[model samples]
Each structure stands twice: as structure tokens, then as C-alpha cells.
Target chain A: MKLTRTGVFTIVVALAFLAVPYAATLLGSNYVITLATRVAIYAIVAVSLDMLVGRSNLVSFGHAAYFGLGGYAVAISAFHLANDVPIFGWAGTNEALIAWPLAMFVAGFGALIIGALSLRTAGVYFIMITLAFAQMLFFLFVALKYYGGDDGLSLSTRNLFAGNRITDARTFYWICLAALAICLLLSWRILNSRFGMVLRGAAASERRMAALGFPVYRYRLAAFVIAGMMAGLAGALWANQNRFVSPDMLSWVRSGEFLVMVIMGGLSSLVGPVVGAAAFLLIESYLSGWTEHWQMVFGPFVLLVAVFAPRGLWGALRGKGDV
Target chain B: MQLVLEQLLNGLQLSLTLFLLAAGLTLVFGIMGVINLAHGSLYMIGAYAGAWAAAKTGTFWLALPAGLAAAALVGAAMELLVVRRLYAREHLSQVLATFGLILFFNGFIAWSAGRSPLLMETPPQLSGFVEILPGLPYPAYRLAMMGVGVAVALGLWYMISRTRIGMLIRAGSDKREMVEALGVDIAKLFTLVFALGALLAGLAGVMVGPIRSVQVGMGEQVLITTFVVIVVGGIGSIRGAFAGALLIGMCDTLGRAFVPMLLKSWLSGPLADGLGGALSSVIIYLVMALVLIVRPRGLFPVSG
Candidate 1:
């Protein structure tokens, strides 16, 4: 196997991510590590969304639903564990091993249900349905005041891993980075698999795939669930990073931002979302620091990308014929 | 009985307001094949413009024309500057580009308006209550709103069903190439339609200004609800929008009024109130879900 240009790019990016904590310590600012962690978590989300948009041609307008659900899973469990209260007749635990899987499961279950109904429709209907369903969940969380309502809940501390808390910023960053790498590897594998081919084929021409006797709907649903689970893990990690969970995480704007990240980074080529997530956060933080009305500039910048650079920063940077 | 009657009227008023927003959105989607997320921004713009004009003149009447004109001008400018370029692009591109427009518009409004909600006073002539029944008094302003909504609906129906412009619009929806081939300047028509849509959204904003605080980001709330209406109704169908709007409006208003009361029978007071409040909010979405399950294409899908 030859080391390609993308291979070199990936290694460089990975090295940079790994060195973030060390640089932050050298600079005596943990904010750099926090921002890097956010990029990693968001990259996971963007990658999950890319599975649908870049590969399956499904433009889900509500991917944040899963992300929020994952966070809520951890928050709710930790709340009960701290309070020594039993929810649904079962005692809650703040163990990462248990809570994280539960988070992924909850999010994947949500996807199964939402996808089942939303997949019934196509095109604009699918987009709107997914969004409305997410909004439904958002409202549900807002209404459930026991979990702190619109104000949200804060974890007493980060979840324990193997009976010990992973409290160090560097350790948490490494864990998140490892998760991102795993997600990227999983995405690459799926993209190369027959299931991925079926999804791509269905995206290209649903009728053609159906004619070829493939279970296109089932394939799509499976991919949707997988993406949701990945986003759930990202969400869980995100909650831990902040030690707070709010209804704001589930808001439609976040879902829209996720789409922006995927499109701005480039789509389908697993690595595009990671680059996109990093660029989005960096630009957002920089502009916000300059002025409160950062969106004014950021908005027009997005418009420029949509109008001019259809393939996004990745495509633009890679030059021609790379895709 | 009187409370139910009042809530029913409230539902009617809300439905009409929603219809105003939905008609334009569906019309654009039908004819332009563009999924414009910025349509709500036009609504907000209309409200802001009207509120500014109303405050300056100290008259609610001026708000009507001001809102309409501002929305139309902005909508036309947006159409020409951004949306027109997106006509040939995919829906995703249109969505993102328009989403960008939303961010720009929202930020611009916050910067200019200082992040505070503008207040519009209800005119004295429309502020008092009128006895619609022998003993039940309804706010005259809301009654006037109902009247305007009905008049606009009738006017829209007449314009779309009877006028030459309406004929061209129907033709444009049915056969875009043929209409363009028949010497109709499609570009001008698109701008006209978009401006008309903006005008209607502005009308809604102006009507709502006195009752609700005119604020930045207000359009997004209405925009999402309007999406539910469009989905419940069918895309590109005026009748579908009206029907969906009525269903959602009635469901929302009645659910909010009665759900807590109904829940109080079985649950404790606080729990019922809290849960009911949440349930009432989601009732329309539940209705939308049921509609999707029963008729995924919406109640009246227009085949493209």
C-alpha cells in the first residue's frame, strides 16, 4: 500500500490534535485544550452527518436530536446517581462504561423510531419530518422539569472510568481523540463495505437499486442508526467536557450548524468533516473574540462557500481531480 | 361554553396568521423549487420595519403599509441578489444559502435594534372589546385581525383563481419551460411572486406586532410552526396550507386550553399543569406525526 497525499494530511492533522494538550500546558492556558476537545467531539458529529449527506444523499435537518439525547442520557443518570434516587425502578450509576453505552443506545433507539417514520417520506418531507421530530424531543426535554427544564442539569463531576474519574484534561482529550479515530475508522470501513455501496447506490438512483433487488430502505435505516449512535457518543463526551447539559444542545440551530460544518469542510470523504469541524470552531472563536456580532461576518462567509466553493475547503485545498 | 367559544376564535385568528406565512413559503417552493430557510427572516424584517414605522408615526395604521413595503422590497432584493442564483442549484445548496441569509439578517437586526424587543401599541379604535355573543365580549383588535385574515384569504382566492397573474402563476407551476417559451419573463415573475410572498409574511408580522413583542428571532419560531403546517398541508398547495393551518391552529389553541384541565382529573395540580403545558406544546407535532403516518405526502400533495 502506498502512502497517498490524504494519508500525509491525516497524519499531520492527527499529530496536531495529539499535541494540543502539550501546547496548552506550555502556553499556560487550558482553553486551548477545551477548544481542541470541542473540535474532536464536533468532528464526530460532522462525520456522522456526512454518512447521510455525502454518501446516502439524505439531508437530515435534525441530527442534533441524537446528539442531545446522548448528553441527556449521561446527565440524567448522573443526576439520579448523585441524588441516590432510583429512576424507572433501577438505580443509576455514573460509570462511563455503563452510561456511555446507555447514551449510544438511547440515541440509536431514537434514530430507529425517527428514521422509521421519517424514511417514509422523501426529499423535503424527509428533511422537515426529521426536524420536527427533533423539535418534538427538544420540547419533551424542556417540559420534563425534573431534569432542570430549560435551565438544564449539571453533572457533579465527570463520569468514573473503571472506578476512577478521568479528570485530567489531557486524559479526556486523548480519550476523545481515540473515539474520533475509531469513528473515522468505522466510517471508512462502512464506506468500503457492501452496505455502504448499497447506500451510495440508492442515493445515486433509488429505483435502480430497488430494481437490482436490494433492500434499500433497510440499508438506509441501518446507516441512520449507526450515525445516530456515533453522534450520541460525541454528545456524551461533550456533556463531560462542559459538565453541564442544557436544552440548547438539542435546538434546531445546532442541527443547522452541524450541516454547516459538514458542507463547509467537504462531504463524504470521512476526513472532510474533521477538518470542517476544526475550521468552524477556530473561525467562530476568533470572530466572536473580535466582536459580539460575529455571525454577521460568518454568515456572509458561509454564503460565499455555498455560492462559490460547492466542494468546500477540503475540495478546494485538494486541487482538481482528487475527489 | 363562553371560554370554549373564545378559544375557538383564538384558534381561528392564529390559523389565519399562520396561513399568511405558509402561503408565500409554499408558493415559492412550488414555483421556484427552492427551499428558502430565510423566509422567516423576511417575517422578522417585516415586523421590525412595521414596528419602527408605527413607533415613529404613533399610528398602527401606518404599520400595515410600511410592513408590506419593507418586506416586499427586501424580499425582492434578496431574490435578485441571492435566491435567483440558487434556482438551478440543489435543495441542499438553497437551504444552506438561505440559512446563511437567516444568520446575516438576524445578526443585522440584533446589531441595529440593540437586542431589545420593540413594542407596538394597539390602536384605540381596535383595543376595546366587542360583544360577539349576547354576553361574551371578544377583543375588538382580534376581531379586526380575523376580518383582515378573511378578507386577505378571499382576496388571495380571487386573485389566484380569477386574475390573469393567477393564470400565469398556475401555468408557471404546471409548466415552467412552456411558460418561459411563451414570452413570459420568468425572472420578473419569480421576483413578483417572491415579493408578494414577503408582503404576506409582513402582513402577518404587522398584525402580530401589537399582540406579541416584535423581536429578532421571533420569525424562527413561526417559521418552524409554519413548516409543520406546510408538512401537514401539502407542499405547493394553497388549499393544503389553509387546511393544515386551521388544523394546527385549532389543535394548538384548544390543546393548550383543555389539556391541563383534562389532566387535572387524574393527576395532582402541579404535575398536571406542568405535564399538560408540555403536552399542549407538542400536540400539534403529534398531529403532524399522525398525518405523516396516515398520509406521508401530506393531505393534498401537488405532483411536481
Candidate 2:
């Protein structure tokens, strides 16, 4: 039960996140709350990606597919609920308990199918194939006219939590914070378990793990599904954040940004992705506010990070063998 | 039949353009073991440079070399400045660093050139149509592009197979250490290969500019498709790239041209249209997936 340095750091960061709404009230602006909620949601997705990139040695360039699917799940459910129509013998409900899990399930199912195929190839092929599948899904959503197509779909209202609709930015921020906390704890538990060891082992050398009778493919696929579901939850929260869902959410660029966050945050730990997500969004927001051409500065900054800070900000702070 | 023929020609034109892009991408990946996400930016630079030159000079001829030179110079600078440091890095770092380069280049281009799309007119003589068959007339400019593509492919084949540099390139990809041990400056060879790849990308950008509007972020759209091409073709295999490009271009063009019509024959209007549009757009990806399932190494993997 003793607190390590990282444990203490985590507590401080958590406390800081909890104080955001109070700070926003003092500042007389809700912008920070909204931005924090976004960071929290993105953190969920980025952490899930780290499970693959950092733990399993699988670098998926299409993790956004699940996120977008999760968002669309919420949007589509809301769409059907508003229309008073039954889809597949069930009436749509705006209950967060129902819609949120549905989003995660849909995203997990998508990962299952994509993973089944993509896992057949390794290295560059795996990366490109995953990307292609994500693009395929993006196009599918874009071409679906009923759900708003290229223009995207808007939710009628925020989903009710336990029969009460959550209103206001502070409330949403707390909910997102709670979700991120639960995800982090669950990820921490899973990564430390024996299964986590096997996953890490498979990543280190798939051949060795398979030879040891670990069923490497199944473990990787399981990890992929879990990560997909986590990202899906983030995507669902994201949809509710804006009350909208767009094909742009599933774009390759978004996927790339997620990768950058995982790498920039520090790889292979529960805390890294959250740190990376916060850093990425804050820097992006700050830079854009300074000038219209923010990417010109941000791009070089990323390059400099890659060249000089290969271990990422967190890893650098933690020093050697930190992960 | 006439429609099919016209679509076929269109497919070929698109295929050749993709081939030009794919060749450079595959070459760089095959030889240097680098996954450069900014290869498309070099293409953009080419198109932008060519478009600017053509606008200023009132001639497309000057634009060709202008595009090539600019792309080569920028590409060389990129190699020396950024990619040189990435030679020994892992693929993830390489992907991120190059991805950063993409963001910088795109933002820089938009900032410097204005965000509006730039137009490049087809050269006067080739702007007109040519009668290939008694009833089938095609744009002469497109025909000219095909000719250029064929010529480049042949030239590439000759250079890779017939010249001393070609021998070095072949040797370099196969055994970098051995080549270096034999007194070849592997670093210089890498830069040359990278510049060569950039030059080809630039040429593709210039050729495609007159066909499609020259604009920021256009490289990304083509870059993904080029990735598909390289994946479908064996990575680093020139023959595979050509084959993959042709397969993807023809499938995509033909699917887009005919899928809706075919769907309309059997289904209702809106559903058919939507389904067909979606299916056609994803057909190439499906093709890639199928290829991976059947042949995980792609159609012509060069490594083993």
C-alpha cells in the first residue's frame, strides 16, 4: 500500500483534474472544463492504444475506427429513439447504461473482425492493413445517407444517467473523470496480472510465446478487443461531449494523433497515455490560439521530441527503467 | 463496350499516376527500411512548384523540370536534415517524425501559397482529343501522360538492371553491410536513392496537377492509396508496385463507374446508390485484405 513516486505523481494529477471545474468557476469561463473533459476522453483512447503499442508490441494505425464506431453507436441510438422506430426488434433508448455499453460492444465487435484479418500479417503489413480497414469503415459511414453520411449525425440530447439527464459542463467533466479513473484502475490491474505478463512476453517475441504454448494470437486478439472497447467508450463519451458524431472522428489523421499521444506520453504504463493526451491537447490549443499556422511550430516540436526525447516527456521525467 | 473502353483508358491513366507515386514509396521503404509518411509532401511540393512555374512562365514544359528540381532539392534537404537521423531508429519513431514532417510541410505550404487550390492548365497541343478508334476519342493530354509513364517505367527498369548505379542499388538493398565494406559510401547511396524517389514523386505530382486541382493535403489522399498499392504489391518490389497500382486503379475506377448502375438493376434507388457508393469506395481495401489473407507477404515480396 506504500506510495511510489509515480503513485504520488498520479495522486497529484488526479487532484488537479478534480479541481478543474472549481478553477473554471473562479475564472468565470467553462472552457477549461470542456477541454479537460476532451482530454479525459482522449486519455481513455490513448491509454487503450498503449496497451497495444506499449504492452503487446502491436502498433495499430487505425485505433480511431473503434472510437468513431463508439460515437456512431451513440448517435445512431439517439437517431432511432427520436424517430420512434425499432431497429432490429428493439426500440432505441437514450439511457447511458444502455447506449454506452452498446457503443463499446459495437467497437469491440469491429475490432474482433479487423483483428482476425489483420493479425495474419505482422510488421508493416499489419500496420497498413489495420489502417485500410479503418479507412474502409470511414468510407462506409460516409456513404451511409440515412445516418447523415458525410455531414455527420447529431444526438437529440445527452443520454440520461440513471433516468436523469446530466446537464452542464461540470457534471459532464466529473463523469468523464470518473470513467477515466475506472479505465486506468482496470488497465493497471490487467497489466500487472499473469495475463499481462504473457501479453508482454508475446510482444517481446511472438515466436517464443507461441512455442511456450501460450496461444499468442488469441492473447493478442483479446488485448485488441479490450483496447477497442476502451477506445469505444472514449468515443461514446466524445459523442456525448459535443452531441454529435462525424466521419472525421475516424480519419487516419486522428489515429496518427492518438499514436503521437501514446508515444509522447511515454509508452508501456497506465499513466503515460493520460499524460500524453493532456499534453497533446493543451499544446495544440495553446499553439492554435497563438497563430493560425500552429502545425508549422507543432510539427517541428514533435520532430524535436522524436530526435531528442525519444523516451517521451514522462519517460524522460521518470529516468531510466522507469516503465 | 465503348463506355468500358473509355473507363479502361481512364483506369490506365490513374494506374500510371499511382505507379509513379508507388515506385518512389516502395523504393525508399525497400532500400532504406524507412517508412516515410512525408513522401506525399514531396509530391505536393512538386505540384505546387510546377504549378507556380507554369503560372509564371506560361509554359508547361518548364514546369516539369521545375517540379522535379524542387522536389529533389527539398527531398535531399529532408533526408539530410530529418530522415538521416532516423536511419537507425525504430519504425514507430520514424513514422512519428515523418508524420511531423507532413504536418509541417502541409502547414507551411498553406501558409506560404494561400489556402486556395491552384490550377494547372494542360499544355496546348496535348489539350485536344485524339481519335484512337473510329468512334472513340480520348484526351490527348491523358495519352501523353500514359506515354510518359511507360517511358519512365522503361527508364527505371534500364537504370536498375543495366547501369552501375543500378547494380549498387540492387546490392545495397540486398546487403547494406557488404556493399559498405566493399568501399561504397552507404550514406551517399541512401541520399541518392532518397533523392531519386523524391524526383519521381515530384514528377507524379506535376503530372497529376493538371488532372486534379493542385491543393494542400492532396498528397495525403493519394498517399493512403499509394500505401494500399505498396501493400498489395510486395513492399520494395518495383514489379509488385506496378502490378499493385494497376490492380487498385482499375478496380477502383471500374467499381466507381459501374457499381451503382449494377446495384440499381437489382435494388431500390437510394439503397442501391448508397450501398454501391460505399462498396465501390472500399473495394480496393477489401482487395488488399483478401490479398493479405491469401498471401500475407503480398503478391511479390522481395525480402525472401
Candidate 3:
């Protein structure tokens, strides 16, 4: 397949991510490696969010619900297994092979229910309902005293990757990178396929797509589930990376951050969210190191981007005429 | 019976606050076509302003107008600076920009006021309890709040239905171009409406500051519930906002009061409490979901 400028840039960026661990080691900075890992994990979520926000025109404000659910799934399972306690009469396992897919499935199931209900509304109602649903789940987790309630739960150890030690920063970074790569590849294929065309068409005009005999709601719900599962995958990786899961993971602000990453990257392109995520984390890390009130500066920056660069960083990089 | 009545009264008070918040949101949304995520920020601004003023003057009356003016000025400035540009943008763009505004406001508040919650004392006169029923004494402040809400509701009805500017507002929401063409400065009308909404939200904030802690991010907690109120009442309808707020307030307050007690017979104490807490928190969202399913446009959808 021929590569466009965006495609080439995406590959170069992916390669750079792969090289980060070596570069960090050369620079003798463990913090850079960890920050890169965070960027990659958040990139997974932002890319997944882009599928709905950019392609399907469904701007979900509560996406952190799925991300948090995925983390909780891992943390809760690990907690149960380590304590030798059966939660709700079911034994838990700390195996990554078992826990990761389960996390995805659990998050996907949540998306199915939330999306089904939220999809019935359009525009602002959809946004607020999604937020409300996420908040509901956030409160649910907060009320689960067995899981540490508001304080959150910590895993005894990171989920084992087929008995491999993922606790090493380099190894965990690689795992996160691989997950993000798979997500990007999958998103690329899905966006190019006929199914993606239907989604884009639906986003453009649901009425027109409906008239064209497309089951728009089903397609949108399917997309929502897919995005949720991807975010859940990211969440699972994040839990393993930190070996901690908190109710803060599911807060609406986290969801807003994900949205910001997607918008900053540029919503129009497949690679935009990844770029957005990296830039957001990097800028945040750099700014916060300098001052405690970094958000005061960052908030206006985001506002300026929203108002002026609606097409996002990717769009600006791709040049104005392309959009 | 007394407990239920008390809970019902609590719901009424809560609903009144929600109506104040939702009324502004729906009005701004209905007329401007902008879905403002920063509406909650305006609420925070009002609370901070009220708290600050109350701290300085030691008077609730002075604090009230101070909060109103602060919020109104901020709202008007926000409309002039950022929201004016968003009038022609898509909803997503509008949402994003306003969301950025939320972060900015939150950060600004925290930076200015510090991380601690501000304390606002209720005026000593209104702090006293009044006998509302034969054997029940209710807080005078809460009863006063309910009265203010009802009066605002009636006044809003009169202004919207019986006044010239109200006619223009109704007309503007329906047909902005028509109103503009008819020699109404649509921009000024929008600013006025936006400021009015901000003032009402501020009024609610000041009134409730003594009852609830005035802190950063408090607006967000109330904002989501206000969103529910608007969604359930049908977006853009003042009447719908009023009805939706009352329904949600009653459901939420009563659910929190009774759901656990009712569940106790079937479940253990801790489990029942957890379940009840979770269920009660979600009661309004459930109502919103049900309302959407049954009447997607809301119960009182205003016809264009």
C-alpha cells in the first residue's frame, strides 16, 4: 500500500516510541521511560475515543467509566486472588491472560448498556447522559468498601505476562507500546473498511444513512463497544503499570483529559490521538515541574487550541488546506 | 409520616436550587445553541464571590448581590470573549471550548482561594428554625430558599410570557435570524439572557453556600444534576426545567432517605447501605434515562 504523509509520520512516530526505552537508558533517566509508558497507555484511550468522537461524531463525556472499569477489573481480581477470597462467590485469578480479556469484556459490556441508553439521545443530551452514567459507576466503585471504597485498591503485584516479569520499566513500556500498536493497526483497518465508511456516513447524517438502509444505531453501538473495549485494554495496562487503581481513574475529569488529548491530536486523522496524547503528557510533565498552577496556563492553551485549531495538531501539521 | 414530610421538604429545597441552575443552562442552550460545560464554573464563581463577600461584610444580604454581580460580570465577559465566537461553531467545538473554560475557572479559583473550602455563615436571623407543621420545625433558611425559588419561577413566567423582552427571547430561541431581521439586536438579547442565567445560578450558589460547603469543583457536582434536570424537563423549556428539577430532587432525596431502610429487611446492613447509597445517587440518572426512553425530547419539549 502507498503511504501518505500522515501514514509515513505515523510509522516514524511508532518507531520513535519503540526506541524510547533505549533512548531513556542512554540518557539515564528512568522517569522518561515511565512518562513514555504513560503516554502510550493514554494514547490507546485517546485513539479509541477518536473512533467515536472524530469518525462517528459521538462525543462521549464519560469514557473514563470504561477505562476505570478495566482498571478495577484487574485490581479487584488481583485483590481477591491474593487474599484467597471469593468475591460474590467467584474465585479471582491474577493471571494477565485471564484478567486482561476479562477487563475488556467487562468494560465492553458496560459500554453496551450505557451506549444503548445514551445513543437514544442526540447532541447535548447524549454528552450529559454519558457523563451521568460514568458518574454513577464512579460512585458505585466509591461505595464498594471491600475494594477500598474512595481510597481505591492496589494489586499485590502486576499481572504476570505468561510468567514474564513485567515489573521492569523497559518491559512494561514495551508491553504498553505493543498494545498501542495493535490498537492503532486495528483502528486503521476498521476506519478504512466498509464498516468504517458506514460509521462516517452515519456521523455525517444519520438520517441520510438511515434512508440508505444502514442500521445506524446498531453501528454506533458497535463502535461504542469497540472503543470501550480498547479503552479498557489501555486501563488494564495502566493498572499493571502503576500497580494501583483509584476511583480517580474513573472521574469525569479523566474522561475530559482523554477528550482533550483527542482534540489536541487532531480528530480528523487516525494518528492524531497518539500525537495528542504524547504532547499532552509531555507538556503536562514539563509544565507541572515548573509550577504548581500549570493548569492555569494549560487551560487557556487548550481553549486557544479548541477555538483556533479545531482541526488539532495533526490537522495543523497536515496543513490547513487538507482539512 | 413526619420523616417522609421532612424528606419531601428537603426534596423541595434541593429542587429549587437545581431549578435555579437548570433554568440558566437551558436558557443559554436554548437561545444560543451552545452547550456550555462552563455553566458550572459560573456557579463556582458565584459561590466563591458570595463566600468572599460574606467573609468581608458579615452580611448575607450584601453577599447575595455581590455573588450575583460577580457571576453576571464573569458570564457577560465570557459571552463577549469566548462564547461569541462559538455561536457559529458545532456543538463539539462548543463543548470543548467550554470544557477548557471549566478547567481555567477551576484552576483560577484554586489558585486564588487556596485548596481549602470556604466557610459562609448563614445570617443569624435566617439560621433559626421555624415551625412549618404542627410538630415539625424546619430551618428558616431552607423555607426562605423555597420561597425565593417559587417567586423566581413566577417572575420568570411573567417575564417570559407577558413582557416584550421575554417575547423577544422566546422568538430568538425559535428564530434568531427572524429576530435579527426584525431590528432586535440579537447579540445584546443573547448577552442579556446569558447574564440573567448567570445571575440566577449565582443567586442559587449564594443561597446554598451556607448549607453546602463552598469549595472548588462543587459546581461540577451540582452541574451534572442540573443537566439531568434540563434533560428530563425537555431542553429549552423553563416550565420543563421546573418540573424536572422537582421530580429529580424528590426522587433523589427520598431515595437516599428510604431506599436503604427498605432494603435492610432483605440485605445485611453494610451491603444495604452500600447498595442504597449507590442506588440513590443514580436515581436521577435513571429518571433521566427513563424520560429519554419514553419521551426523547423531554416531558415538556417546547415546539419551535
Candidate 4:
């Protein structure tokens, strides 16, 4: 493929993102580092969601179930590993590097199960069922008493990455940046692969895909699981960032927030999620200061965007959805 | 036996309320092919409107009709001003727009109502109990709700099935081109359908006000139930909505009511209580999963 103008522009934007934190570092501001870390984490989830919502045409309103499940896994595992207790004389490990894989597995597995059942139906049923299932998990977490329940569980500190490096803000931010960079690369690779084509085909014409002997359901379910696993990675970062995991992370509202990130960034583009994450967090930061009813203002803004500029911020800026 | 009867009555009452909510939702989806997430907001509007009116004048009856009217007005305005544009847009746009509306409505109402649950006291006329079939005492209001719901159901069936206008709606959903070719104005039909749908939802809200606390987010919870109802019943089918609503309402109410008792009989109190509450919450989803497995299109799928 030729190095097109849009591709170059994406590189420039990404470079800008990478340089901004360092630029802030030179200016002696730590706030940009935290914000950068958040953008990277949200980018991980947003990119994954794009596979389903943008390419596959599956509008899952319950993606938070996987994300929250992943967060809980890390939190629960860390607790057990720290406490070193077991009913059958088994102890959990506090090694988050090892625990990250476990979180991904749990989150991915949960999405696969939910998606397998939910993807059976289409249209309003699909959206509502996914939402219903997600809400079920949300309520389950709220009812679950042992691991913090409704109030959420907090870690004593952030997870360790080969010693105290994880505790350092700069080190942690770099790790998140690297992790997100790797995810973007992986997303690119997968999107260009045969599996990605199948997802796109299934999304574009499920019936045609079926007529052509392609098992559309498997492709979609695979995409859903993959997205869930990516969101799990984001969840791990969120837990480590705040050293907290709550039922709110798994709520329907969070799913809506995730969608907003995707929509604000531009649905069809890869880097749009990252850009969207930055804009949304910034908007959230300033809006919350304006009034307690920030949502009311934000809601109408979203409406205006939907009505007037359906292509979103990235799409509007780039002539050909070059995001 | 009496306890079982009461639970069944409770389930029936809940089902009646859900039927009213789902009827509008299914119709909009069927006729307009639009998913209105703010449908619940209309229910919330009805509740708050009625609550405010009833509180001011101490007249539940007056408040009920007025509340329904206000909700219908909001629904019609939504259809005309915002939702009309989304008719040809993608599901994503529709979702974003409707979701935005939900947030806007919640915040707007919260601003006005002060974020507290508004109390709706029962009217004097419908405050008593009615004994049915040997000491099975039930609230007259709930029984009246059931009666009203049944009457509405029958009225809807009569309109849609037996009337020419109803045939037009059915035709409009399945084949709009064909309906148009038959000399019917499809655009006008859509707006009318939307208004009617809102009216039903508003009535649902008004009926539900007396039983539940009228609050900002009450409709949001019930909306989830309505989704399950429409899904299990089959979109674009009123009969499907009725069956699914009653089925779901029964499962949810009975599950919540009986799970603890059933568990307590065989297990310890604390464990039973914990599992019971969790299990009850999941019952509707479980039922939906079961229905999807058996019939993906729903129990009473619409014929194209």
C-alpha cells in the first residue's frame, strides 16, 4: 500500500501525542502525564470497540461487562495474592504482569459467552439483550459483597512492575503509552488480516457472507471477544491508575461513555479513539467545573453533533474519513 | 395459597404496566423502525407530571389524564423536532440522539423536581381493597389497572386487526411502498403512529405512578423490562408484546418474591437471602436467553 496523505497525517498526529507529554515534562508539569496515561488507556478500549461497532456493525451496549470483569479480576487477584489465603491451601499471586493475562482471559471469556447468546438476535433485540446482560452483570457486581460490592475495592497501592518502577508516575505513564502503542499496532495487523476481512464482510453483508459459506457468527463472536480482551487491558490500566475498582466501571453509563469516545474520535479511523479520549477527558474536566449538571450541557452538545455533524470531529476535519 | 395468589396478582400488575410501556415501543419500532431510548423518559415525564398535578390539586384522576397528555405532547414534539431526522440514519445515530435525549430529559426533570422522588398519594375512590374468590384481597387500584390494561389491549387489537386503519399500520410496517401505492400517505401515518405510541406510554406512566415512587429515573428501570418484553414477544407484533410482558413480569415478580422463601426452606437464611436477590435480578435475562434460543424472532414473530 502507498503511503497516502491521510497515513502521514495520522503519523503526525500520533507523534504530536507522544511529544506532548515529554514537552509537558520539560515544562515541569505532571498533570499532562496523568492525562496522557488516561488517553492511552481509553484508546485501547476505543480501538477495540471500533472493530465491532465500525467494521462489524454490532452495536453492543454492554461492552463494560468485560471491562469491569477484567478490572475485578486484577483487583480480586491482587487482594488474594496479598492476603495469601486459600480454602484448599492455594494462594493467589500478586504478580500483575502474570495477572494481566488472567484479567484478559476472564474478560474475553465473559464477552464470548454473552456475545454468543446475544449475537443470535439482530436489531433492537441485539442492542437491548446486550444491554440487559451487561446490566445483569452490573447488578451482580453491586450485590456481590465479598469484594467491595457497590462501594468498590481499593488496592493499597498500584501493581508492581519488576519492583517500584510501577509506583513512579513517569514509569507507569510510559508503560501505558507503550502498551497502547502495541495495541494500535496489533489492531492494524488484525484489521489487515484475513480475519479482519471476514469481520468486515460479515458486517457489510451477513447474508452474503453466509451465502458465500462464511460462518458470520464465529467471526463476529471472535471480534467481540477480541474487543473485550482489549478493553480488559484498559481496565487493568484503570485499576492501576486509580488503585481502585468499582461497580460503576461496569455500569451501562460506562458503556455509553465508551461509545462516546468512539463517536467523538470518529468511528471509522484507528487513531480517532485516542484523539477522542483526549478531547472527552478534557471536556469532562472543564465541564464538571462549570456546574453539577454538566451532563445536561454535554448531552445537548452530543445531540447537536449527531444532528448536524454525524461524521464526528475526526471525520469533519478529514475530507475522506482519513482518520 | 393466599401468598401465591398475591404474588401472581403482583406479577399481573407488573405485567399490565409493562404492557403499556412496551406497546408504544414496539409500535414505534414496527411503524417507524426507530428505537427511542427516550421512550422511558416519556414514562418518567408522565410520572412527574402526574405527581406534580396530583400534589398541587389533590386530585389523582385529574392528574392522570393531564400527565398522560403532557407525556404525549413531549413524545410528539420529539418525533417532529429530533427523531424525524433520524428516520433514514443509521442505528448508531439513532442511538446517540436518543441517548442524548435521555440525559437531557433526566437532567431537565432533575433541575425542576430537585432530584427527589415525588410522592403520588392514592385517590379516595380507588383506595380500598376488593376481595376476589374467597379472601383473596387485592388493591382496587391494581385490579383497576389490570382492567384498564386489558381494555387497552382489546381496544388495540380491535383497532389493528379489525379496522382498516389498523390494517394500514400493519401494512406500513411490513411494506411501506405497498402501503403507499395503495394511496395512503405514509408520512402522516408515521407521525400519527408516533403520537399514539407516546399516548400509550404516557398512560402507562400515569397508571404506574400510584404503585411506584414517581422519580427521575423510574422509567429507565422499567424501560429495560419493556425491552425484554418486546424482544421475547417479537417486535412489530402487539400480541407478542402482551404475552412476553406477562411472561416476563411473572418471572421477575415471582422470582423476586419466591426465591428467598424457596431458598430459606432448604438453606440458611443469609445465603438464601443473598443468592435469592441476585437470582431474582437475573431471571428476566435468563428468560430472554431461553426465548432467544427457542425462537430468535420471538414467540409471535410478525409475518412479512
Q: What's the DockQ for every one of the candidates?
A: 0.73, 0.78, 0.74, 0.64
Candidates 1 and 2 compared: the better one by DockQ is 2
- What TM value does model 2 have? 0.98
lDDT of 3 by residue, A1-323 (tens): 97667767877887889789889979999998999999999999999999999999998999999999999999989998899999889789788899999999999999999999999988888988899899888888887777898998888899988877688898888888889989998999999998999999998899999999999999999999999999999999999988999989999889999999999999948889999999999999999999888888888898899899999889888775653
Query: What's each prediction's TM-score?
Result: 0.98, 0.98, 0.98, 0.96
Residue lDDT tens for model 4, B48-143: 888889988889988988888998899889998999999898878888888888888888888778787878888889899999878787899999
Could you tell me the lDDT of residue A142 within candidate 2? 94
Residue B285, model 1: Cα distance from true site in angstroms: 0.9
**What are the Cα lDDT values of the candidates?**
0.92, 0.92, 0.91, 0.85
Residue A297 CA error for candidate 2 (Å)? Answer: 1.0
Q: Is 2 or 3 the stronger prediction by DockQ?
A: 2
Q: List clashing residue pairs in candidate 1.
A: none
> Which residue runs does candidate 1 get wrong by more than 4 Å?
none
Q: What lDDT tens digits, residue by residue, belong to model 2 across residues A1-323? A: 97676777777778889889889989999898999999999999998999998888888999999999999999999889899988897788899999999999999999999999898888777887888899889999999988999999998899998888787788888899999999998899989998899999988888898899999888889999999999999999999999999999999889989999999998897788899999999999999999999999999988988887877878876667645
**Positional deviation of A105 in candidate 4, in angstroms?**
0.7
Which portions of model 4 miss their true places by more than 4 Å? A1-3, A26-29, A82-90, A321-323
lDDT of 1 by residue, A222-311 (tens): 999999999999999999999999989999889989999999999888788999999999999999999999889989888888988879
C-alpha positional error of residue A137 in candidate 1 after TM-score superposition, expressed in Å: 1.4
Per-candidate Cα RMSD to the true structure, in Å, reads 1.1, 1.2, 1.2, 2.0
List the lowest-lDDT window of 10 residues for candidate 1 chain B: B268-277
Clash pairs (backbone) in predicted model 3:
none
